[model samples]
Target chain A: MIKVENLRKEFPLGRTLQKELATKEKIAVAVDNISFQCQPGRIFSLLGPNGAGKTTTMRMLSTIFKPTSGNIEIAGINAVTNSRDARRKIGFLTGSTGLYARLTPNELIKYFADLYEVSDADFKIRKEKLFDLLDMNDFQNKRIGKLSTGMKQKVSICRTMIHDPEVIVFDEPTSGLDVITAENIISLIRDCKNDGKTVIFSSHIMSEVDLLCDDMAIVHKGKLLYNGTMENFRSNQQESSLTAEFIRIIHESNAATV
Target chain B: MILKIFLKELKDTLRDKRTLIMMVVIPVLVFPIVLNLFVTVSSSFEKDAAMQRVKIGFVGDAQSPVIAGFLEMPAAMGKKDLIPYPNEKALLQDVKNDSLQMGIIVPDNYQEKMDSMEAVTCEVYYDATDLGIKDRAKSYMEYVEKSARDKRYKSMNLDETKFQVILTNYNNTASDKEMIGKLAGGILPYIFIAFGFIGCMYPAIDLFTGEKERGTIETLLTTPVSRLQILIGKMCVVALSGLLAATCALVGLYLSIEVFNLVDNEEILSIVRGILTPSFIIMLFLLLFPLTVFFAGVMIPIAVYAKSFKEAQSIITPLNIVMVLPAMIGLLPGIELNYMTACIPVINVVLATKELIAGTLEPVLLLLSFGIMVTLAMIAVFVSYRHFGKETNIVM
Candidate 1:
């Protein structure tokens, strides 16, 4: 299980000495006071618009960045402080490839496997299964630099799941992928949740989030606007679609915050 | 776990033919091209008429035995083919205008100084700004002194050996080629150490900074491994690659010596074993590794701060210039090095290598140097870990 409490991140407007001496005219709060939890064997998504702090929140939970004021626990480990341990428990895949271009797909998988130090038997079996499941065997031998974007995406997904951590996070997994590839990723997400893993994803794609997320929180400008199941979210809004509901709630939330 | 990442880097870097070629092929071939060019240009320069010929405009009398003898003396020594002028002032004027390669203002009292054992200042005039003219002028002056000394000895009715010694003293032991090679060799140690260190610096920075630039640091950090372990594993691969390149450069230097017959003062094959010693190996291993770590520690934080590989490269390129220039200090004669140099990172390595090359390395200096380097490397590796752990805004 993963938990975040009062997670907040604010960016100072200037870094230069001259600029720093001048008072900041504007302050950007990437993530405002927000909280959520994902129980074991559940899939939760953070559905929000652009600049909604969904990615920033996920980044903090993944231990890539620290929150300005927050505490996060991934699999009972303090992700904010005991990040290395938390990292061991989480398999993170960002939508923009973490793929190293010069390595072959086979090499990329094994490298991650080594970094995580998966036992030989488990590594071999897991790699074989991922190759079979994702059909990576066709181009696994080719350098990732030569691989198509969709192929690289498959490799990225394989690395995320390589360690088979208790917690998994994918930030915008299928955002740039084509229709077929995107559907494949959706199915992969469903499979991960079915395998009794705590899976969390952040996406602006409403239909994918609406169809896949078991529980979700709608976030706008760093604040949690709503949190519940899709049925609960649907009932609260008169907007025709989730994206429309997202837009309507954001305007309403913005007006209230001001 | 760091071993796993290191092995992965090794296997990946090995397959990069372009970089392997850059690391291996270029350094190996560079020695031959440089050595051959030096030899060809030097030999051609020595034999060229411009090097030997001195055209002097003499305003003095040729019919008079004294002025005629002064001009004919160098013409006989096979050093200079003296071109005469009408008068002394005319010779000085011609030299001033650069018409004469060398100018001799024969004294108006030329005949008087020889009778009095008083030394006649020849008033050898040539533009000191032009090096070739200055050297030729000095050579011509020596020839005049020899001629005058010979005349004095003959008048005293003494034999060639006794008169030559009493009248004029020249270092008969002087070997010009050996002198030139000594000069060249002084510069060689600097290039060898500098290029060797530079050769080490690139891959060290590449393995550490380049790895961070490639976004592998985050992935590697997530593993349950110590930062020291990661540093050691990666450093092992870099050190081996650097040492391989250094060896390739050394071998290339030897082969160039043999192939081009560069520095004909001694046989390269005969002295090769004496030159490459246990001291050389110890100095490089002890010296190069710590220097590598210093750079590795120094570079990684810079690499960590950058958002991309290109930015990291821009930060590290100036370092190449810095390393190369100090290694070049070996070219300057008798740059004294002591323990104080060991405290300075780049200078110590070059001095250490020069000591090893000259075969005078002390065990104490070696230990002191190696200890400083390794200690610094550990500190650098520790700092890199902090760099990774802190500063959230900077990307891997």
Candidate 2:
């Protein structure tokens, strides 16, 4: 399970940024005070528009960025204070996550496995199972730079799941992918959920969120507009559709601030 | 974990064609190609200069004692053909038109002056631009004058030694190795510094900035390893690349001397071989190791901070000049390793290497230079860590 309480992230404004934003504030808050929990064996969705801080929030959960203030617990380990140990329990993937193009899939997997300190017996069993399930046996030795988009995506999924961590963080994993390639990610998320892993993915696509998430949070401009289970969200929807409701919430928040 | 990262990075770096070219191909081939060209071109020039027969044009009577003396001069001073002219103007014209390589004007009463023991000045002219011609002319004239003086001395019937006074014998106290070291030792460290910086450059940029640009650093950061471990692992590869490049250059130089026979002087060759002893090489590496680390350290922060490979390159490439410029100072004469120079980073390494080659390095100064470089390298590593830890810098 992944737990976040009052998690916030702030980036200092450079002189250029200050001028561009026309603000004298020394810092720009990317993720404001917010709290949510992702239960194991269920999929939770963080929904936001561009610059909505979904990526920043995901980064903090993955221990890539330390929060300004708040607490992140990964599998009962305090992620902020014991980040390295917390990182061991988290599997983070993003649509923009880049693989080492120069390395073969086999080499890349082994490297990450080594980094996570997976035992030899476990690495061999996991590698075999992943390669077979993904149908990656034929091109595992080919350089990733030469792989097709689908092939590379399969390799990335295998890489992320190689350690089989309890918490999986996916930040817009299917953002730029074609439907055929995106299916691989959709299935991987399903597999992680079925394996009883705590999964949280951020996406702007309401259909994807509606299709996969058991619980959801809607955020806009760093603030959480809604946080509840899918059942509660569906029952409380005032708009004609999920997308319309999401748009309505954002518009209402903007109008209220203005 | 650091070892694993180091091995992976090394594998990745070796696979990069740009890093391979900078770290291996160029450094290995540069010395052999340059040395071969220098040797071939210089020897051809020497052969051409030696074989050409100079035409000597004279404006005095052909039977004059001075002309006879010139005719009798040895052939080894370089081959010559004497041509008689009616006057100095015709001789000058021929010399100017390249019909004659030189011109000599012996006075009409040259024999009378010689018989009377009066001073006689023979004017010899040659173009300064015509490389060896002027020296040949001076040598020919000096030979004829010396012979004429000997003849005059014989006629005087006095002891030749009586007029001589204050005979001087100058000697050098330094060894051939020391002389070569002081004069040319700057080149060794300069090569190491140049190649080391270039070698560190590509890997440093590719491993740090390239990782960020390619979007791979984020995944790496999410792994279980500490950031410091990753930094150090990547740093080891960068520093090794620099050392490898410098070593390739040294190997190239060795090939030029041993296999290519670029240097033919037996004495010089012996000195070079002696200077490359195991202890000397170890000492050279001792100076170079921290210097390469320092180079890697200096470049890593920029690489980590840059948003793209091009951005990192634009910043670090100019820094090469700033870093390597101090090594050039060692090429200058009289800039020995001292307290002040020992504290300066690149310059200290250069001068210390020079003194090492000359076998004159003080132990205290070597320690000081090493300590300073190591300290700077640590500071640079710390700066890189700080930049890398910044969320804004590491990710776009």
Candidate 3:
């Protein structure tokens, strides 16, 4: 399970020394006092548009970024205080993160396993299972630089789930992937949920969110516009479709802020 | 866990063609070829200079028996072509026009002076800007002075050897090995430091900034490893490659010197071997260790700040110039390793290296320099670790 309370992050804008000395300090808040919980055996989605602080919130939960003033509890461990321990309980993936171009999937996976302190026997078993599931055996020994995009994505998926962490956070895992590749990622997330792992992912596509999310939250301009089960969201929507409902909430949030 | 990161880096760098060419091929093969070419060109120039005929023009009457006799003797004018000019002005014109390498304006009363046993001056003129002409002119002047003195002795009815002034002059007897060692010491330290820094530059940029540029940094950060562990692992690889490059550069220099037959004397080769004692080799490694560490420590933070490989190269390439200018302090005359200078970083190491290779190492000074370098290296490593801890640097 993952728990975040009053999570807030502020990025200071660059300014000249004279301006900084004369005017009040300027900051753009990326995450603003938002709270959410992800339970085991469920897929929780942070649904938001671009520049809506979903990635920042996910990064904080992964312990990659320290929140300005917030608490993150991952698998009952405080993420900020025991970040290294918290990291072991979570696997974070972003669309921009890439595999080592020079390393074959076998070497890359083994290297990460060693970093995570997975024993040789366990690594061998885990490696076989991931390779088989991702259908990466045919080109497992090929350097990732030579692999196609879909093949590389499969390798990335194998790498992400190698240590089998309790909570997995993915920020737009299928942003640029083809249809078939995106479907593979969605199936993998479903499998993670079936394995009783707490999976939290962020995406903008309402259909993808509606298809995979069990519990979900609508985030816009760093604020939580809605947070509840997908069934509750569907039942509360007066619109005919989930996309229209998502657009309505965004419009309402923008109008209120204005 | 650090070993895992280091080993992966090692494998990746070793497999990279660019790294192999920079680290191995250039040092092992290209250096020797370049060295041989330099030796061949310089030695051929020396031989050509020795064999070439210098043209000398004499002003005034050359019909004098004394002047004719002096010019005829090959000892006084080796491989020279003598010319007669009508007057001093004519001789000067020939020299100025580059038609004659040197012009001698013999005093019109030179014969009278010798007959009367009085002093006389024969002005020698040559273009100082032309090195070849200047050198040959100086040689001719020396020969002319000796021949004139001999003629004076003969005119005075005295034996030249019997009337010679009796005095013993002290002279240096330093061996060729000691001379070569001193010369090499002055030059080779800067070269080694350059190679060491070059070795570290690419790998440092590739491991630090290249990962971020490739978008792999985020994945590495999400692992269970701490920032310090990651920093240590990357630093170890960079340091090892730097040390290996320094070693290869030294070996290349030594092999090239031997292959070029720089010193033909067997005695000199043996003396060189004796100077390169086991103690000397050990001291060299000791000095290079901290230097390479300092290089890696310094490179890491700078490379981490860079956004791409080309950007990092731009930042780090200028650093080689910065390091080299300080290391060149060893090449300056009268520069020596001492208590005060041993505290300075690059210059201290360079001066210490010069002393070590010249077989005049002071242990106290060496130890002081080592401690200072190690301290500075530690500070740099600390800075690199702090840099690794920042998410903005990695994520950017």
Task: Give the number of the best model, judged by TM-score.
Answer: 3
Put down candidate 3 lDDT per residue, B175-203, tens digits, no spaces: 55556556667666777777888888888
Cα lDDT of model 3 by residue, A1-258, tens digit: 999899999877557533755755687788999999999999999998898999989889988899999899999999988989999888887767788999999999998889888889999999999999999999999999999989999988988889989999989999999999888899999999999999999999888898999999989999999999999998989899999999999999899889
Expressed as tens digits, the lDDT of each residue in A1-258 for candidate 2 is 988999999999999999999999999999999999999999999998999999999999999899999999999999999999999998988888899999999999999999999999999999999999999999999999999988998998998999989999999999899999998899899999999999999999888998999999988899999999999999989998999999999999999999
Question: Which lDDT tens digits does candidate 2 get at residues B60-145?
Answer: 87887779988798778778888988888889988888999999898888878877889788888887778888778777778888
- DockQ (Cα-based) for each candidate: 0.48, 0.86, 0.78
Poorest 10 consecutive residues by lDDT, candidate 3 chain B: B69-78
TM-score of 2: 0.93
lDDT of 2 at A29: 96
List ranges where model 2 is wrong by over 4 Å. Answer: A20-22, B54-70, B80-129
- What class would a CAPRI assessor give candidate 3's docking? medium
Q: Fraction of reference contacts reproduced per prediction? A: 0.36, 0.95, 0.80
**Deviation of model 2 at B280, angstroms:** 1.6
Q: State the lDDT of candidate 1 residue by residue for B63-101, as single tens digits.
A: 534356555763443455567676777777778887776
Extract clashing residue pairs from model 2: none
Task: Record all residue pairs in model 3 with backbone atoms less than 3 Å apart, i.e. clashing.
Answer: none
Location of the lowest summed lDDT over 10 successive residues in candidate 1 chain A = A12-21
Q: Say which prediction, candidate 1 or candidate 2, comes out ahead on DockQ.
A: 2
After best superposition, candidate 1 residue B216: deviation in angstroms? Answer: 4.5
